[model samples]
Target chain A: MTDPTASAEPPSGPPARRRGRPSRAASAGTRDRILTAAREEFSAHGYDKTSVRQIAKAAGVDSALVHHYFGTKEQVFAAAVEVAFAPALAAPDTLAEGPADGVGERLARFVLGVWENPTTRAPLLAILRSAVTNETAAAVFRRLVAAQLVRRVAARLDLPDAELRAELAAAQLVGTALMRYVLKLEPLASADVEEIIARVSPVVQKHLTQP
Target chain B: MTDPTASAEPPSGPPARRRGRPSRAASAGTRDRILTAAREEFSAHGYDKTSVRQIAKAAGVDSALVHHYFGTKEQVFAAAVEVAFAPALAAPDTLAEGPADGVGERLARFVLGVWENPTTRAPLLAILRSAVTNETAAAVFRRLVAAQLVRRVAARLDLPDAELRAELAAAQLVGTALMRYVLKLEPLASADVEEIIARVSPVVQKHLTQP
Candidate 1:
């Protein structure tokens, strides 16, 4: 099987996808491959060391093609991080269906759920590694996380300090990620998901609902 | 005037600092200078790119002097991070004097207080930059933070799951540091310290006191 994430069309199927726009970059699934390569490379080598040429080589594309689609190394990282954060970005809307009181549990479970999966966790870790080490990369991550995730959740709160509340909630989850995933400190690392959720969800609820 | 952090003895007055062990490295304050340079170099260039020769150059000493005092770049980082985290390490014990009910506020304010000061915050940001990007450096940092601070705080809580509780509290503060200091995301970043403490203390309190 050709990597299922590349495109909807099967590998044995036709060369073209999206009949209206026949751009080879999209049609051939080269962009997805490049992103996959970029995430792996960045995760392995970090932001400062990883180069556009390396990402292109890993993607089996010319450097020009990587640049044509993603611009600079920083830009490539930005795009990769955005894709990594997709589940998190959609969380506010998808988890907002319940009453505000339950928003904490819903959001906590959802955020932790993303980290619980190794596939999703890797890219997010890459984004975090880059942000912590490189200022330019940090700016990209800060903008995406703030404007895309936290601010959206804040907007749903309809409170004066909704932004701060959302940020605190983000900080809590992000901090846990650093320790449990990156640092792998136990028993936080080894604790069952249910145990963590039971302890953390109430804190999340308090941040969202407290006056 | 000599750098005050180097030693109590005047730079011009006496070469012997402790008089017990007049080791030239300790007496002349060469060790202190190396550490200072190491912290600055690591902060400026990051862990992977920095070298012992460069640190020695910045300290105005021979590379052998750096090697003599600190052994390796990673060892130098350990020493620097330990110094950087001294304030935080002292906190679990010093701040524990208050009633259990006030542990949250005292701990929150104290941790934020460490971040509030630019002098203490820089080395921490440097350590964080290294830990996120390099696995070896991350291990050094993980051990220091987990053993020196979190575990100590856990021991104090006297709860069965005190370790997890302390880790959660740490996650809260560390997360705030990433957003507020490293990422500089606002209003969390630009927001007044008092305002943050007020909003955050209650969350911290719940993490520690909630069983």
Candidate 2:
């Protein structure tokens, strides 16, 4: 619920009756705006360089509002990561929809598609870049991937060493992303998404399915 | 050749006769010393945080000497990467010694071994951290991996999509390094070297040897 007092004090308008809590939509919108700005600032400046004041400024809100919403920069970052990786966090479910044999292709398609999409790729890149440099960010990132992404996929396999296999598959896909997206290594970077999926999916499939 | 002026000066000792250009070995030693200090400083502080003055102080030399040896911070970082990745840069030759099928195992063993070795891993970890955050460092790192490491392996493969395959193999290995060494992701981080070799080599083998 939005604070009634704050909602009632509108700029260039007479004070209206402070009715019941301002709409959930308005509160959620403010939270989303803060997160979007936080993602951009963190991505651009990394965890150490970014400040709450800067994020608040970027979001066009007061610093106190940011603190009120997110508590700390770390909390804000965690929320931002959650927002950025929401699609990827859901990607493990894609494993359930397809045949076991094609899980690798589906997985690869989903990951590469995320990287190829501007919407997902931007924040993911920022998180990735931050993770690489900042220990705190890296810890958060590790938990997200290991607990949420990799482990979830590992759960799908009805086999021994399922966790290891899932991680091996992650290593291949994450490695591909490191090179193609982050490092921008040529040929691989310039290669079509389809080509990458073709070459990489089998390896993923093999890692996931092989004994 | 080391500078005659620098070599003549000794701490708490009589000044030796100022000679002509110092021996190649002496000059090389200074360069190596500077690089070692650079690696340590860069590792501890990262690229943006590290300064030539600090590096020189760490190396027991003047900032001018650091500049004299490595030209700029970028050049110093390049030299440090070269030193850190020397063994890995030479890894392609290992493929030539063994049968083609075993190359994957050999490659995995060599890479994981490098990561496992604390002596090499320390500076490498620093370079990796720097590369993730600093664009300039990333460029140097990209050149080292693409030009010196991955491309060399691709050249040895002699396959139709040799470059792509080599990179895919690199992607897997690099990804593993990212997770295990950089991110310190669980299981993989603590996973036994041989166990990882057992699991990852086949995928590397597949990426490399497959049509």
Candidate 3:
């Protein structure tokens, strides 16, 4: 390796083209760092309360870097939320291969899988919290979840009003999450995920496929 | 007949035991003052954002007086949200008495009553905003809403899973509200409440009473 003080003479020719590997690696690292801080800030403080500076500080980066990478606070939040809910999007594919004897059980398994994982759960908590405080955040969250999670499940059913039913089913699952994880309501908070799916999935499936 | 200077003296002997009529008037006025200010504060800045001090200042009263009258911020918020949702609460009772052949029409009328009025809509926004952000607020809101509005409707329905259906029906109503008002989403936002009710109420009624 060259000495620490040695200059790269080739870089002075044409603005020194950035090596794709280093830039891509640097970009991903910064992006991940921003998301980590955003998840924490948004969860604890909420959307309206969470500032760009706070997130940047937490991530140990300049605030301008966050802005450069994500563009705005909402974008940063949306990116974090997208990552948070990514598992739910993968469920449709997973469920497709599972035996059809018990769609409800499969769906419940998918839902619990997302909510139980610390990686997914924390970001979802932030989204849920933000959805209540900032209207813009809620809209962004609703569109993302509706399209990625709710609609996929809905499409699996053949019903006239599958869209509305899907929304209803989504509400139940989301409501349970709110009560158990966020509100810490009793009985539900203590109940196992399998039990919750056993109790709640038939209701969701009924809404989905039933007339 | 007493001298003007003597009239000012602590009302002479034991304050004349203050009469009943003016006391009632004063109490009503104080209650009204507190509610009116609370509404304005909750409306202007939402539940989590508004403080008792802000409300007290708006109402031209001591913050202690506001607490003395309402007990807590939640109590004040509950009152506001209750007043906001009361008009819609009348739906179950109206459905109980009205023609069942036009169930959708009747239900639509009742839903419109809540959405069209600013007094009802403002505090509702505050409560919903709080429900999304604060766990304590969400628990109280869910309890108050379920007991006062949803349970009443569910009790009138004779179905295998009336409670579950009730929750589902509520999800329809609340989810729609979240979309239309909080998100101010397209089509749903500009669409007349009557049209929404016409479209949605049948689904609600079906969830409630259908096998």
Candidate 4:
């Protein structure tokens, strides 16, 4: 038995495997662990109530390790928001630079994509759930949603009230998500994505270029 | 003094002081009381979690009385929403039908008036908060806001995309409230109504009629 397994003596043998610019498996693995724990903690406790130590404890790592990896709670939230909002956020920039005629389709596809993705939708649901009761979390959410996403879309449009129109479009889309996914309303909840787009895209187009 | 007090009892005791109504109190008073209680409960617990029995109990009445008055929880909620959204709901149909120059000011004044009135604002805040986490609440909210408010405003305008534009305006205004009152963010929280109107009205006007 000793001859057969001579190389497995050290329980932490993986640490020795990194001999250069850091192994992808080691650093990426720790980062993933931290994010998974942070998502759970933030979703459960909300933004204002969630703490670094709590997140670290859940991740089975030292608190210092969380700070070393994520920097701050806001940064972690931003990263999470980036991931959660990526489909929608990425859409505006692409749509602005893409074929202008089908902006409605692009916008609808973007919203449906994000809401349909389970990985991002859960945290987004938590964020929406917390936004009402928790003031601080709501602020973070508003900034990420309004200033970051809607404002950017507004800036891209050539209309007179582009900013306002963009915000309006954002509201309908987000409100639909709140109603369908989080609230689980009847007709809307059961409606297919294409149906949602058919009904809603024209509305978005109106906002973008109706002037 | 005691002799005079005893003598006054002989005069039908001032008509027995009338236990329930008619003593300078209308039947509507009970409705008002129940609505007030419902607002407080919904604000604290949201719509899905708040029960009619709880609202009735808080109003110091029997649950049967609540059912007798409002018929069902949905009706009661609808009444509460109507009262809370009265300003916007009651915005003269003339505003939408009239010439569209000062619509920015009109819309701004209407929104500010609703937010400033405790009677309306409190219940509205509860409804808006609940919309974040509850589906039934959100659907009702969207129906009320969109049909009563947005559709009316859109119908008044001649633009092809009037409905979408009106919705966008609502989003900006509602988003501002969420940031200020619900989220309690700085600068926005402290900003005066006039300031908000000045900044937001042009945007609203653009949505209303910008060619």
Candidate 5:
């Protein structure tokens, strides 16, 4: 493991990479460490309160290194959001796996399934909380979700106003996540996962395919 | 220091509220003024940062009177949620207004319409932001929504697991609100209200009426 503070110990705080090229694997590892730390910080403190310095400290790196790697707090947050949403953004592909009639169920199950797992749920919730409260975070989030998930999902639909349809479908899943996971609204929160999948999948299906 | 004329009916008031102070009557106008101030405070500062003193100051009432009428800050928030949700909680009756197929559109329109109105949207957004971030806020929000809206709507549905169905339907609308209003995600955010109602109504119809 790289010494997180070694570079900063020098008079100039240039990242070790700037002094000399490190092994690609080591560089990737450092990047990953920073990202993990970013996720944890963002998840715990949210976007408005979390600072790059805090993330660097958490990762045992200098704040300059975080700037070197991610440019800004907003960028770091975007990167963190990307990691959390990567799997779910692949949802359009998931939707293609089953018959069109079952697409709604598959899509519903896919989105909710991501939330069902504890490990993934933390960062997603963190991203969502930040998005709701912070304007910058929300813009970054809206851009990614709009660009990555909604538009792609829209592309898959063979319908008029496909963008609207895709977003509406997104609204269904996002809302379910808020109620069941974020707010922990009862009935929805306590209801069986499969039962929810059974009930909501059809609604999703209609949004995706129906007129 | 009690102003007998200001609260002449305090001791024998029908409201029977006895928490903040005995300085004011639990008159509807005064109670509403406190609640309005509370909603504005909570909306602007969220649950954690807002205080009874601030709410009372905004309403030109004593803090003790706020406590008197609302008991605790949590109770005050519950009261605020009740006001914002008053019309929404009565959605069961709205469902009874039109033909079965049209129910979804009517419901969708009713909800988005609430959001469309500036006066209503602000407090709702504030309440939503608070609920998502604070545990007590979430509990109060969840309880109000579950008790007031979901269960009532569930009672209207003649289906098995009616409560679950009602909650699922709620997820759809809440998610849409998160996207369109809270996050203000594009496409969905800019889409015409009628268009949204058209797209989302059938989905609601399925959730409320279908097996």
Candidate 6:
């Protein structure tokens, strides 16, 4: 493609400055690059220590371009968290795919499975580490995980105190992740994923379906 | 009371240089002060950002004196964790005072009660935040928690995989604390303590006592 919009780098002429807008695909690519860089920077340095300029440097872009794309560091962190957790956040919808009786098992398997995978675990771990120490980051993380993931799962269930139950179930899973992944506590940290699921799913199931 | 060891501060003048040792109580008090300062420093700045010099300054002691007392920052952190968790870690022994069937409820109440109290929660939260980000800190924290807290509770259970079950129960409670305290996730964070006990104790009870 010889299309002017298809170029990965901006054209090297005065006309490049005059261009009204880049193609939608090109904009999306730049946004994705910035997000990837932000995740890496935040993960390595945490919320307080990381800056937009550092993120932009990591992304090989101008700092002003990062501001143009994400506005503020908090907004950038929010966007990064949204990307990191997108898969796990979508996992609650799968509860509908299985029989009502096995929903707990399905939910446990889904949540833990996301954590067990290396591909998703790295970025998610960074967000979690930062969130644990930084209040602002924690707030964004709490809002996203609660609203997008936990509450949605609660809504699907027909039970009293559904939200509370859903959150309780989440506590079990989230705690497991914190211990096994973050804290690296023994037996739990080294134990097989299936074993954890076996022990924890029933608890989750009880929280979800039981009164 | 006339003994040189009874003095709160080092005795004034040349006599101080000739003294063999301070009173045991005074030494312990100095150590306690240092540990308290270490906790505050770690809490405010976390592991990487905290310094031995900073802790010494806060404790109103020379940096060399801090080293003489605690040896290293890691040792200082370990000591701080021990002091911070002393009450909660001791709660397991109380399980012996209650009936087997009620162990889960007692355990949940005891652990959550420790978290509910502000005196212990502040320093413990610092350790948790440090553990989440730094591997060395996490390892030290994991060892102390596993050895001092989780395994001790597991040992009391007559059930098979008592350790695993104990850890699983811990996961639930720990998860609840992470969400409610650290992440401040809603419903769970704001919910009445008794309601949380009513909902979570049974799950914890199941994990510990059930197959």
Give the top-scoring candidate (lDDT): 6
In angstroms, the error of model 6 at B24 is 3.0
The CA root-mean-square deviation of candidate 1, after full C-alpha superposition on the true structure, stands at 7.1
Best by TM-score: 6
User: Residue-wise lDDT of candidate 2 within B69-109, one digit each (tens)?
Assistant: 66778888998988888868777887897898899999889
Task: Give the worst 10-residue stretch by lDDT in candidate 5 chain A.
Answer: A8-17
Give the clashing residue pairs of candidate 1, or none. none
How does residue A119 of candidate 2 score in lDDT?
A: 82
Worst 10 residues of 4 chain A by lDDT: A1-10
DockQ of 2: 0.65
Off-target runs (Cα >4 Å) in candidate 6 are: A1-21, B1-21
- In candidate 1, which residue ranges exceed 4 Å CA deviation? A1-28, B1-28
| C-alpha lDDT values of all predictions | 0.81, 0.82, 0.65, 0.66, 0.81, 0.83
All models, DockQ values?
0.64, 0.65, 0.20, 0.17, 0.69, 0.72
Q: Could you tell which candidate, 1 or 4, scores higher by DockQ?
A: 1
Writing each residue's lDDT as its tens digit, candidate 6 over A152-188 gives: 8888997768888888898999889888888888888
**lDDT tens per residue, model 5, A1-211:** 2344455332223254466555667667878888999999998888888999899999877887777777778888999999988767778888778688888888888888999998878888889888988899999999998889888888778777888877888888888888889888777888888988887787788888886
Model 3 DockQ class? incorrect
All candidates' TM-scores?
Answer: 0.85, 0.87, 0.72, 0.60, 0.87, 0.90
Off by over 4 Å in 3: A1-27, A91-119, A142-211, B1-23, B98-113, B116-119, B157-164, B184-203
Worst 10 residues of 2 chain A by lDDT: A8-17
Clashes of each: 0, 0, 1, 2, 5, 1
C-alpha positional error of residue B104 in candidate 5 after TM-score superposition, expressed in Å: 1.7
Q: Which of 1 and 6 is the better model by lDDT?
A: 6
Error of 3 at B121 (Å): 2.4
Q: Which ten residues in a row have the lowest lDDT in candidate 2 chain B?
A: B8-17
lDDT (10s digit) by residue, model 3, range A126-172? 78667766777887887886678657765776665555655655555
True contacts kept of 4: 0.22
